[model samples]
Every structure is written in structure tokens, then in C-alpha cells.
Target chain A: MNAVSRALTDGWVITKRNLIKIKRVPEVLIFVLISPIMFVLLFAFVFGGAINPGDGVSYKEFLIGGIFAQTVVFGATFTGAGLAEDMQKGIIDRFRSLPMSPAAVLVGRTTSDVVYNVLSLIIMALTGLLVGWRIRDGALDALAGFGLLLLFAYAISWVMAWVGLLVPSVEVINNASFIVIMPLTFVSNAFVPIQSFDGVLRTIVEWNPVSALTQAARDLFGNLPPGETVSDAWSLQHPALYTLLWVVGILLVFVPLSVRQYRLASSK
Target chain B: MAVAGNDGDEGVDELTEMISATGLVKRYKNVEALRGLDLSVPEGKVLALLGPNGAGKTTAVRILATLIKPDEGTAVVAGRDVLNDAEGVRRSIGLSGQYAAVDEHLTGFENLEMVGRLYGLGGVASKARARELLERFDLSDAGDRPSKTYSGGMRRRLDLAGALVAAPPVLILDEPTTGLDPRSRQQMWEVIRELVGAGSTLLLTTQYLEEADKLADDIVVIDHGRQIARGTADELKSQTGGERIEVVLVDDGDRDAAVAVLGQVATGEVQSGDSERALTAAVTGGADSLSQVLAGFAAGGIAVLDIGLRRPTLDDVFLSLTGHATESDTDSDAGSAGGEGA
Candidate 1:
């Protein structure tokens, strides 16, 4: 095999190794799996009737798009945590000593994490369905929604992988990702509509990729979220286009950047 | 001790020089682990880097393997520059670090196979290589087990086997047998010797004098991050001067008097012994000096239980050159009791 295929093969081998860790010590994936499910239950049951906002949709169904967006953006933190821990454990040092391209490491790790995010999405969606979440769109639209979330999460994993590589320790990873993810999630339309907030907060959310993703998913799931504050672009009319834009944009900015960081880090 | 640079030898064996490092220096924060270190390995030869802890042997290996860059210097493995052609260097050299390099999550078979694959072996070739290594390393029985469950020696062997999976001409090992039991250590020594026999040049750092004596065709001794001595085993011993004059005293009472007598006869200071048993020391010349040493002890009325003249050991060479023990017992009660009491 050539360089790229060899790298990808190495990546898959590494990815399988990590997945085995998650399999044996499954507690690693538990937080990622359970938190979203709990949020689905809490928002759909505990506070759904009280908010009683319009659109005649059950709070459970309405919250699906918003929480799916929240779950994946939140999952970015683990990407940093995993890479940092691997480095601290000297596993990354072993990888550095190998002949494989350094970029393969971050790519493999990010791809594996996206697979976990996809699993988390499935668990969250199933839990949402069990509690009466109904999709009003076609199977294709639902599949597209799932694809969008995974792509966004995968892109974010690259950015966080860079953070993990740069950070000195995994302890810093745990602390920094939370500090970064919390504000990014809250300021977006994950918990509330972007229009409900005014002034600069509204401006930030209107342009926020998180909001764009959530609004896009909501439209695809037929949850019927509000629209058109950011631009007159086609994505403003279709959530699919908006989600695609954020996914593509994140890939463009972070993937190469993370790969570059991985290269520099291994050499040092 | 001062060091002189290594001059190129007359005979040329390009395949034997699996690794060559010149003026290699590695810095960690404010500390220099390697200071202008130079090394050469003839094809199908094992070179042992002998030093105590913190002697920069590991740092040298890291630089040669391209796992870490040097502060200033150059290393080449299979003629690939460690700085300019790092990937090429990596492709040709396999490194077994101070720690076990196995992936804990992967089975032994998977770990070896993955490393093999990383070296560009295709599915069938990599798998075949992994299986061959597993059997060669005597790990076939444990190949399916997670490496975490393998014993320390087993893990170390597996790690070394992983390094060889790529069939690299150069192998850099940092303290490969540091923690293994005596039996395992011997086994690893044999494995390394066999590798050299098969045309793989190996540069290994180790604390075990016997390992160096047994395996290394060339020996380089480092202390405080400098190459204090470098030569073949016999050459090093010969450079240390004559054969050792060792005596075992019949009683503890004669120890001091024997020291005084030998102090007069030998060029070096007499090494003292503990209170309980015997006095042993190394000095030059065999039979002629042996009689002189015995006559001196007898004149001093120091009873001699046993006396013998033997060839100088690596330890003798080390002490004759550096005046320090290879395995310094800093934790001996005689040295540390006061501190512990305080």
C-alpha cells in the first residue's frame, strides 16, 4: 500500500486498539452515553409541560434537535481528554517512534471518537424515541440529520485533538474542555431559541455553528425551529444546508490544523 | 576521566554499521542527558552502552531512533540522518524504550501485528511476521493475551519483538533488561546476540556488566553524560592494566593491616571492606606481585585465608578508570544510617 492507505490502515489499527479499551473499560464511554439520555428524560418530562411554548409540539420532540446538538459539541471535550491521557501514558511516544505518519494518529483518534459520538447519538435518539420522540421527516432526512451530527462532532474532535496535543497534561484537558464547552453550548440555541436572547448574546448565537446545527437538525426532524437570522443563504431555509456548512467549515479550519499540531508535537 | 574522539577504523563494513551517531546532544529543560556523544556499530555487532542511571544512555538511543531531537548533533541509522531524514531513520531503526512499549489494550498478537503493519507490511506479510516473532520470542502461548497480564520479562520480550517486526537493520534498546530476573536477562541477551548473528546491528544501554561482557563486541562506557571510555571487552580490560590480585582474609582482624600492606605495594588506594567477613581488592600483575603482596601481608602479620590472581573484570576496568562502583550502593546502611536516624 501507498502512504495514505498505509496511514489509514495504521489509523484503523490504532482506532481498534482504543475501541477495545472502551470495550473492556466501558466506564470511559458511560458518561458520554448516559448524560444525553438523562437530559432527554429531564427536559422531556420534568420541565416540558411548564414551558408550554407554542408550535403544538410535545417538549420531548421539540428538545431532540437541540439536545442532539448539545450532546455532540459536548463530546468534543473527550477527544482532548483521550489524546492527553494517551500522551501522558507514553502510548503516543510509542506511536512517535513508529514509521507511520504522525497525522494518522490524530485522524485515527478523531475518526474513532466520531464513531463513539455516533453511538452516543444512537443511544440518545433511541432514548428520545422511547419517551415519545416522533420524526415528521423521511428516513433520508433522519439519516442526513445523523450524518450532520457525526460530521460536526468529528470536526470538533479535530479541534479538541489539537488542544489535547498542546496541553501538557490530561488534568488540564478535563479542566479546559469544560471551561470551553459550557459557554459554547449555553450561548448557542441548544437550551433556548437564539431569538429569545437579545443584543450581543443574540448576535453570537445567530452566527454560532452550534445554533446553526441545532436549527438545521430541528428542521430535518420536522420539529419546526425558527429561522433566518444569520444570512439569506440557502441554508437559512434548509437545516441540512446550515449543518453541512458548519460541518464543512469546521473540517476546513481544524483538521489540517490538528494534523500539523500532531506532527510538531511528535517531533518535540 | 577525559575522553578522546573515536577515529574511523580501516576496515569498511557498511552493512554492519546499523547505527552511527556523532556529537549527539540532547537537552531536557536545564539538564543535558547526552553531551556530544559518539557511537558506531559494525554490521552484525552488538554495542553495549554501560552506565549507571542518569548517564545519558537512554537519551542517545532516543536521538538515534528519532523519537527525540538532539539539541545539537547528528545521528544516522542505515545512513539516514536523524535530523534531516527522520522518517527514513525511523524506517530503518527499531527502538525498545526504557518502558515496555506494548499497547496495554491490544492482545500481544495484535500489538505485534499492528507494529508490523506500521512498518508497511501487508496483511499476510505482517501477520506472518507477527506470528514468527511471537514464536521466536517464546510468546506464542501468550500471544492472544492482553500484554498487561504478561510478566515483566514477557512484556519486555514482546516489546523487543515488536521492534524487530519491521525487520529493521538497526535496533536501539535503552535498558532492555534492566528489570528482568537473571534467567530472563540471560534469555534476552541470547536473543540480542542471535539478532546480531542475523545481521541486525544493535545498540543497547544496560546497567548489567555481565550483559556488556557477554554480548557487546564493542563497549562504550558513559558517566555524567560523557563517553569516558570506549573499546572492545578485552581491550577495555587490557587498558585497565594488569590482572587483579584478590585476597580473602581468614579473619576480620587482619583487614586493616592487609590494607596498609597492599597500600604500599599497589598504585591505587586500597578499597575498604565491611566489618563482618573479608577484604578484597584489585591490583596490577599476577604471580610476581602476588608473592610481593603475600610477603607484605605476612610481614604485617595479617593472616591470609585465600589469595588468587584473576583477569580483570568489567567492574575492575570501570573502577580502574572512574574510581566509582558500577552499581553504587548509595542506600547502604553504612552510608545512609545517620540520615535515616536523623
Candidate 2:
């Protein structure tokens, strides 16, 4: 086989190895499947009454899109943590000594984590619908929304893949991603309408990629209440296209970057 | 020691050079791991890199296996340049590192199969090879269980099996039995012996002198990233002395007299063992020296509990070369040597 095909074949093998880990270790899977359910329930009930999306939009419906955006973004950490753990375990050394492609480890890790994010997304969506979130748009539009979320999650996973290689430990990746992701997810239009914040914060939320993703999901799922319009910013108006741009931008910057790091990351 | 001469005289055939490295200098920040280290192994031969911890054995293996590039110098394995044609070198070598690299969450079967497939074996072939290796390693009963459930020895066997999955012509094992129990270490040695018997050119590193003596056809002794000595085990032993005479006194009070008696017939300084009553001394005339020592001890009324004339161990060879004991025997011989120096 050619180099590209060989790399893909090797990457698929690694991906399968990772997936088998998730299967054998039920504890890891339990946390992955439970976190989204807990998020949906906690935000829909605890913060549901306290927040307003304006114009009679149920907080549950408004929150679902935001939660979807946040969950997938958070899901990217799996890629980083997995890579960090593998680096520490000496498994990367074995892989490096092989005749496989250089980029195969990062590719396999990020791709397998997309499956994780997809599984969590399905769980979160089911929980979202049970708590009074509705899909008023056509099935094709909703599918597009989920597709965008997965694509965005996949891109972010590469960013985390790079972080995982840069950090010394898997625990550090957890804390480091938390410090960055919390502010990015919470400051956006994920939890409340962009109009809730005023001036600088509102502008920041409007331009945030998380905001674009949430806005896009709300638009595609038809979750926007009657007589309510998204923010006037170009990013919010073309939410789907804006989120697509972020996805493309992230992959372009991080794929090669993470692969470079993986090559230099030796077992300590 | 009569370090085996690097005359470049092994028939001058290019095909015999399975592994050749020159001036391999690797530095990690302020510490130099390899300083002008050079090594060569002919085809179908086992060359042991013998040294204590932090001796750059792992660094050399990593360089040869294409896992890392040296800061300076170049190596060729299986006729491919490690620095330039790394992939070609990788295709011809299998490396089992200092630690078992098997996935804890994957079954023994899964880990081997994964390695086989990554080596470009087809799915069916990978599965078949995985089974064959599992059976060979005596891990067939636990092949389906995750490696986390296996014992330390079982995991090591599986890791070695993973390295062999591709059936590469050259294998590098870095401290494969470092942490294993005696039984496990023996089992690992047996497996390695079988590989050598099958005529696979092998390079293995170890801290254990007995391991090198037992397995390697040629041994290179490294210290501080440089080779201090290289030769066949017998040649190395002879370089230090002909044989060792170890005597254990029946009473601790007789130790000093025994030391004096042993010192008289000894060719080199007599060294005390861990126990005050026991001592080992290098002797020149072999069996004649052993009889002389026995007669002296009998006349001295040392009343020895045990005595024997044994061939010199690698430890003695190391002491003769460096004036210090092996790391494992640091407490006793090193202390005696230090005291004598003082």
C-alpha cells in the first residue's frame, strides 16, 4: 500500500485499540455517558427558571443548543487526555519504532474521540428532548446541526491533541483544558441569549465561536421562539457559516501542529 | 579486559553488518547520555550492552530502533540508515523497550494483533500470528483477558510477543527482565534464547552481569555513555584474574586472620564480603593457588565454614577495571575498596 493508505490503515487499528479500551473500562464510559445527562438536567432545572431567552422562549429550549455546543467542546478533552496518557505509558515509544506514518497516532486519537463526542451528543439530545426541548425544523436541518457539532468537536479535538502532547501529564491536561474551556463556553450565547450581556461582554459573546455554534444549532433545530431574532452581528447572522469557518481554521492550524508535537514527544 | 579488537575483520562482507553505529553522541541538556559510543553486531549474533542504570543503553537502543534520533553520529540497522532511511530501518527491526508497552485495557490477543496489523499484516494474518505468539509465550489461557489482569511475567511475555509479531530480522530488547522475578527472568531468557537459536540478530541491554554472561556471544561493557570493555565472557573473566577463592569463616572472630591468610596467597587485594567472616581474593595459579590457600587457612586455624575456587564473575572484572563494584553490590565490595583506598 501507499504511504497515505498505510497511515490510514494503521490509524484505524489504533482507533480500534482505543475503542476497545472504552468498552472494557465501563467506569470511563459511565462518566462519559453520565456527564451530559447531568448537564442537561442540572441546567434545565437549576438554572432554567433563573435565566430568560426573551420573547417567551422557554429556557429549556434555549439552553439545549448552548449545552450541545458546550458538551462537544468539552468532549475534545478526551483526545488530549488520551494522548497524554498514551505518551506516559510507553505505548507511544512502541508506535514510534514501527514503520507506520508519523501522523497516525494523533489522527487515530482525535478520530476515535469523535465517536465519543457523537455518543455523548446523542445522549444529551435525547435528554434535551425529554426536558421539553423541541425540534420544530425539518429532519434534514436538525441533522445538519448535529453534523456541524460533530465537525466542530472533531476540530477542537486536534487542538486538545496538541495540548496533550505539550503537557507533562494527563491530569494537567484536565485542569488546563478546564481553565480554558469554562470561560469560552460560559461567556458565550450557550446558556442565555447574547442580548443578556451588554457592551463588551455582549460583543465578545457575539464574536465567540461557541456563540456561533449555539446560534446555528438553535436556528437549525427551530428552537428560536416566535418573534425573536438572533443578534445583528455577522457571526450570529451567518452562524452556520461562521461555525464552519472555525472548524476549518482549527483543523488547518492544529493538525500539522499536533503531528509535529507528537513526533518530538518522547516518553519521560 | 582483552576488549575484543574492533579490527573490522569479520570477513569484510557488507551483509554481515546487521547493526553498525559510530560516534553516537547524544546530549540531554547538560548531561551527555552517549559520548562517542560505537557498536557493531554481525548477522545472527547476540551482542549485549552491559551497564548499570543511566548508562545510555536505552538511548542507544532508541537510536537504533528509530524511536529517537541522536544529536550527533549515525547508525545503520539492517543495512538502512537510522537518521535518513528511518522507515526502512524500522521495517527490519523490532524493539521491546525498558518497560512493557502493551495496552493494559486490551487483551493479550488484541495487543499482538494490533501490532501485527500496524506492521502491515492483513487482518486474517494478524489474527493468526497473534494466536501463534500467544501460544508460544504460554499466554494462551489468558489471551482473551485484558493485560491488566495478567501477572508481571505474563505482561512481559506479551510485550515481547508484540515485538516479535512482525517477525523482523533484527530485535532490540532493552532491559527485558529488569523487574521480573527469578522464574520470570529465566522464562524471558529462554524465549530470547529460542530467538537467537532461530538465527535472528539480536541486541539486548541489561544491568545484570549474569544475563550478559549467559546470553550474549559478544559483550560490550558501557559506563557513563562510553564503552569501557568488550570481549567474550571468558576473555573478560581472564583479564581480571584466573579464578576467585571465596572462604567463609566458621566464627566471626577469625575474620581478620582469614583476611591476612587470604591476602598472602592472593595476586590482588583481598576483598571482604557482606559478612565479616567471609572474603574473596583473586588468585593467579588457579588450582595450585586454591590448594595453597586451603593449606594456609588450615595452618592459620581459621576453621573455615566453606571455601571454593570459582571462575571470576563479571563483578570482579568490573572491579578490576573501575576500582568500584557493580551497582547492585555497592554496599560491601565498594565499601571495602573505598576503605583500602583510604
Q: What share of the true interface contacts does each candidate keep?
A: 0.53, 0.81
CAPRI docking class of candidate 1: acceptable
lDDT of 1: 0.76
Residue-level lDDT of model 1, residues B1-342, one tens digit each, is: 011223445344244455777887766555566678888886678899987766777667767777667888777678678889888888887888767878887889989888877777877998999999999999999998888899989999998998898888888888888878989888988898888888788888887666787888889998756899998877787677646666778887777778777776665766654534455455655577779888897777877777777666656666878887665434322222211110
lDDT digits (tens) for residues B69-170 of candidate 2: 888988988889998899999899989877799999999999999998888888999999999999999999999999999988998899899889989999
Best candidate according to DockQ: 2
Tens-digit lDDT string for candidate 1 (A1-268):
5767766888887787778878767887897799999999988878777764345666677688888988888788878888887766666767888889777788788878887888889999899889988788898888888788888888888889989988847788878888888888788767665546788777777677777787778777877634424343344445566667777787888878877777656421
Real interface contacts reproduced by model 1, as a fraction: 0.53
Which CAPRI quality tier does the interface of model 2 achieve?
medium
Candidate 2 chain B, poorest ten consecutive residues by summed lDDT: B333-342
lDDT score, residue B205, model 1?
Answer: 87
Q: Which stretches of candidate 1 lie over 4 Å from their true place?
A: A1-3, A225-243, A266-268, B1-16, B234-278, B283-342
- Which candidate number maximizes TM-score? 2
Each candidate structure's count of clashing pairs = 3, 0
